[model samples]
Target chain A: MSTCKTAIRISAKAPRITILPLIQRRHESSARRHKKLLHLPQAPSYAPDRSAPSLIFNPPSSSPNVYHTPLKFLPKDDKRRTLYQTALNLSTHAALRRSTSAIATSGTPLTTSSHLPPRPSATLPPPVRAPYEKKYHLADKEIEEIRRLRLSDPDKWTRARLAEKFGCSQFFVGLVVKSHEKAERVEAEHERMRTRWGARRRAAREDRSRRKEMWGRDE
Target chain B: MKRIRIARCGTQLLAPPSPRRPLCPHVVRFQKTITLHNYRIQSRLQSTAAAREASNFEIESIVEEVESSANDFPSSTWTSPRHTPLELLPSPHPSAALKSAKLAALRSRLSLPPRFPLQTLARTLIHPSADPDPTFNNGSLSILGANLLGYYTTEHILCNYPRLPMSVVFAAQWAYIGPKALATVASEWGIEAAAEPGGEIDPGLLQFKRLRSGDDLPTLLKGKQAPWKWNVTMTNKILKSDEFGSTASRPDAQQLQGMPVPIEEAAQSFVRALIGSLYLHLGRPLTKRFFRDHFLSRHLDMDKLFDFRTPTRDLSRLCAREGFEAPVARLISETGRHSNHPVFIVGVYSGKDKLGEGAGSSLNEARIRAAAAALKAWYLYKPLEVTVPSSTEGEVDTSKWKPNMVDCGEVIV
Candidate 1:
């Protein structure tokens, strides 16, 4: 709750509009991943609001980037309106985008509920900040999972699924996956023989010494 | 700041300060008809006894005569054109006509109101090559009309002859209706009138109907034919011309809401008709020199064109060229020459100063435009060309396109 005016410095070159389609595509993939994660063997007693998540996140006249409406669309009654409004308010505030990437990449859903933590933030609209910028809990393991998925699947394994498997929220999972994967790569390369990295320098020194011996013989 | 001066500013003939001597009736009457190049011209003069004649009675009487004339002749004669195009003939002896046989009887035909001197100034269809046969007089006024060019050669006659006005003003009384006058006269005299819109109104129409050509046409045009009155129609048409071939505005939709025909159109017709008569009175010598020097001179005064009230940027353009080609590229092999005849090309800008404003729609359009303007200037002013190259542009070719036809001198006077 540190409310001191965080400069929230913005660039004159705002985020490229190209991020919109990427976000839409990413959202579609994330939804699929989320569906797989929460594939309940038994159907709900009553039909769950298939349309709720969409309505809850979408605000009328909102940025073209933020498509999903979060208000519990399945339940026509305004039961989840407050929560939906809060989320909507969060997405629109210029201040929120910079704060969340750290939390977003954590591996475990912090709520500890059977239901997955919200995955929408992991697949933010292009105009919004990237996953690496969100706040997250399982930053390390989430980063590892993101890396592992990238190394394996032709298409990406979304942040939500990685967080679910790693028992963390997607936003947190996003940060971890980004961070750990990079660390792992460096460690793996260091352990492998350092000669490959030093080959260029060694070759140059040897060529110079051999030329010096040949010139000495001529003298 | 460099404005071109039009010579017609001093075009007033105004019966030149006469001290009570009657107008030389010989040239005004029979000689006008007798003149080869100016044969089709009619008088715009007022009648001597017009003071005594009743205003309303004259028109009615002429109407009666036209109808009677139609009854006299059969319908077969209603289609013959009065004159043919004059062609240049081999050199023959001088058979010029100064004194006419029925000069007195023909002089009686000079009965129009005095204020408007002559009526019906039309060109003959005589070509220069077929001349010496008849139709051409070395000393006479030359009329302007596409049909008349066939009667005389454009090279020998129109090039050398002055540009005469083409208007017909009669005693307003005898010259009211247009079609009926010709139709009645043609039927009575058993001769066809110049049935084509721009052909000669058969001479018999005048003798029998007591009316000149194009005279009875306006009144006889009734119903849809009469739908377009003079001034009203011209205004709508001029506005339409602004939008013609333009996608920027829909011409049909912008049609006049309904404007009244002012008296200006008729006034133009009247005044022009009077000028035509004066031209005829000047006869051939003035007409010849005018074409060679004034009307067809290398220099053309462009101010006389495009009235001042038209403030539209498109209509206000003014440009001229001393040579036949463009002032810039000066493209083309054939440029007009002063040695031969000073040919000039003049241009008037109308409408927007965009594409097709001055001349070129594209760069190609520009060349065609320049060529056409030069040709028109050469015809109207007959100015000398300092030099006409062996080559000239024919069609618009930006990469380089030239005209096939020999770009010869087009004399205007």
Candidate 2:
């Protein structure tokens, strides 16, 4: 047992340099040094201006913090309220300074003098398809004809096909037409498909439906 | 006059002509009437003794007030027989409150003032089921107390967290002073229930007809259909439902008379009646103090009550409504992206300011969590100084009053 202990000690102290070469160690140290050198500059100071007479324009964030008291909730005479406002002003000033410098270098003319940037011109992004406007041009006789045709050939003149023929949305086509037989046939087909599902698949489907019900509860 | 004449004629026929007095007609008539009255009293006493002997229950004699002329007889003779036993009374008599040690202990344990009568306390313990009579039971007082509790709780919640969603507000109310919560409070106060409710039971013990095991719930206590078949709107709930925002209305205490009720129902009713009786006896200020100490002091996490779906969408909508910049979720940091348990820290930002930050295993989960946190912060905003509307009630001085801010309500998605 004494010999075994000495042997273990000897092996434990074996030179680790053979496993990790000197060159690799040098490279690792250099990589750490490079990382240190790549550190970003410090953020601008947000010290409050003690001489400022009026409250600053710092707005509260939606951040959830038990200790944080929003400016709106703060008492009118609270000392922290003024300090928070001044800090926000200093930060915004720093941001404005950075943005102005970028614009100057880019040679883009600054049009507005407001603190915040101008809002985007369009409320929504560009549509994937051609923008369709409601015309309200379908006559009562035409709507009746569309409904009659949809009822006659329930499978052929489907919602999509009817919508295409009438130059209207599928939703509008559905509102104008109804076929109880088609609905029943579709439901029966879905039911037959569901019956064919194995135990695992059936359980998974049931679990999915249960999870869907919990969505409204935000579980 | 006819009765007197008949008695006189009978007395004269029965008695031989009174030769000892040689009395006039008027004298004879008077003498005969007095004798007849005495005979009638004797027969009534005999019948009462026989009736008392026949009954198994003890009969107590209650004094009856007699006219001054009739008071010439002994006071004991004027006593009327009471057939009903004391135990047979529906509820305990008010005078019994003084004799109950449990009641005295309860009064002292509650730190109630000496001026607060034990009779009222005893009455509060008698649930409508135990004593169907409204005058004896706590039914009316419980109704008054229920209203007061709802009013106080509503004002407190509204004042403290003005921006809580309607559903969440209802949940908070339920958490604080709902039937279950009140029942828990009663048990915490060391209230014990009687084995069976009767006039013979201790006045301190909660008295309600116990629903036998395996017995079905009473019709009034059973769950009822919602006012609407589908889509029970918040407005409808606010207007039509109880304080807890339940679709089915609360069961009327009077309707549950003589019906067996669960222990929880009885306990809650006792608590409400106590509060109502306190308000009546001790006035507003003391009742408010009692409420603050007992009900308000309970620990309920307001944050846990909120259950949000589509929090991200809700946050964006809230920002738009409040004229703030649209929220954008940005990944702040990540670890072990390729590993089984990858963690992502995400921050939701509105323009230059970061709204909220959350860490989760998946980026989407983190973003959703961050949005939820932001929404929670907005809803849970508490003012440094708040004075509820109830605080100003019945106050002569208005100098310390500060108007509360009523928010435009929660964000709708």
Candidate 3:
């Protein structure tokens, strides 16, 4: 049962149709194509590469054609590739990351050999380490004695002196010696020790921070 | 378009039989005497007799056409019990559907199938607020549609961004098919609302009782006046709450029947009903296409939705959690440090890898910005290809399907 059929017909022909409707059809099809492009099923991986550069300079895609903005192509061994890869994996929420066991186990990129060897990090500021010795194991009685000594002569038995005698951190010394009544005096002494910036310098610092906050907005 | 009186009578002719109407003895006897197919002819015969007695020429001519059309059908004593007058009906008569230019245009606009009856399309426009009757209103359809919308949207979000924080996921869902978004979609479809719904009104127009201006929302939709309990967890939201994960219980669709509602509520119901009706008539594949074309086509910047309080601390915590070296915010570059507008570029480095970078006027501010940037990077990870669970449903070709990467979920903070 073949379904194909061939027909020969004698027809009474009419006048040729106007081009007006045909032109309108062409225009409509083009407009539809334009609209279709605007809603194209974008590749998920491509969105990041397209978005990363704009986000680096401006946190948000302010322009409608942000996807059209050209990204700098990096070579496989480019040092900037590491920077981009690192930036791509930055943590968004601290609490959520900490709450989940994902902190140490997931999303950490393996250390890849770079074409450009990394510069020595010695020039950067050194990380601060806890100065207290846990093994010193100052007895509760010893802590009590240190506190008592500091209180008896607040001027002579300072936090540093107490720390040195106990072979513990000055922070620990301060914590053991801290009293509500002496808080004001301690604050005043710390205030004196703080690096006092001029009014212009302080204003500059405030302005810089405010500017940073403005930049943080993803627009 | 001119209202055809013949079409109106034609609908009356096709009207379901009066339900044991003892009040109108004559109509009941007339109904019992003739079948539905012959009822129009009988009514026309009576109208013809009246037209002849009254000497009405126009009525006589129209009656001739009705008689001839009735003759085309083989007569049978078939009647189904139904009660409702043409004028007293909550929604427009179904016969008005073919005559409505708006309905015809909408059918073509959506590229609906020719077999998909216009009567169902008209029914989708009648919100429960306008038509209290469940059979006439889109109440049941909207409920079904709402569930379908939620399923499609949730799967799309989860499969695409599996690691999005619960709050962010909820916000994204709200951005897509939530009340406001659905209402926007309805208006974008060029749906117009009737000032008042009646049997004579156009079936194409959305029909609903509008809330008075400056009126407070109904108690059900108004939500809780007090703050939600502190113990409300994401798990609770997933299990107990609506699709958008709000704490407040959704207002019952049935309870809102015949009650005046906001335009947004009415419009949302219409959009959902359209989807529901489409699914019922056109089935799953077309419904999915419609969803993708309409709802998913919207533009929403996921990154901008995030609001962070303390990002620097978060970055450090993130580094610690990932077993990375402690994050150090180092001065990358700076200019005019001594000037009023001194700029400082800071980079947050985890060991040798620089996580993120930002420039600011102050070192501390730059550091904060860098930290925030780093956090955004971590949160916005998307997989290359994902097959939503619903896409594979009832399919024999499992070979092409790739399991979606389900992440460990967003950071709790």
> Could you say which candidate leads in DockQ?
2
Fnat by candidate, in order: 0.00, 0.07, 0.12
Task: Give one digit per residue, the lDDT tens place, for model 3 in A11-75.
Answer: 23744444443221133345555665355443322344343465332245221221211112122
**Every model's DockQ, to 2 decimals?**
0.00, 0.09, 0.07
- Against the true structure, what is model 3's DockQ? 0.07
DockQ score of the complex predicted as candidate 1: 0.00
B67-89, model 2: which lDDT tens digit per residue? 22232433343333234244666
lDDT of 2: 0.72
Tell me, what's the RMSD of every candidate?
Answer: 36.0, 15.0, 24.0
Model 1, chain B: what is the TM-score?
Answer: 0.19
Off by over 4 Å in 2: A1-83, A86-219, B1-84
Worst 10-residue lDDT window for candidate 2 chain B reads B57-66
Alpha-carbon shift of residue B261 in model 2 (angstroms): 0.8
User: Each prediction's Cα lDDT score?
Assistant: 0.28, 0.72, 0.68
For candidate 1, the lDDT comes to 0.28
Against the true structure, candidate 3 reaches a TM-score of 0.61
Instruction: Tell me the lDDT of model 1 at B321.
Output: 21
Off by over 4 Å in 1: A1-219, B1-264, B267-272, B290-413
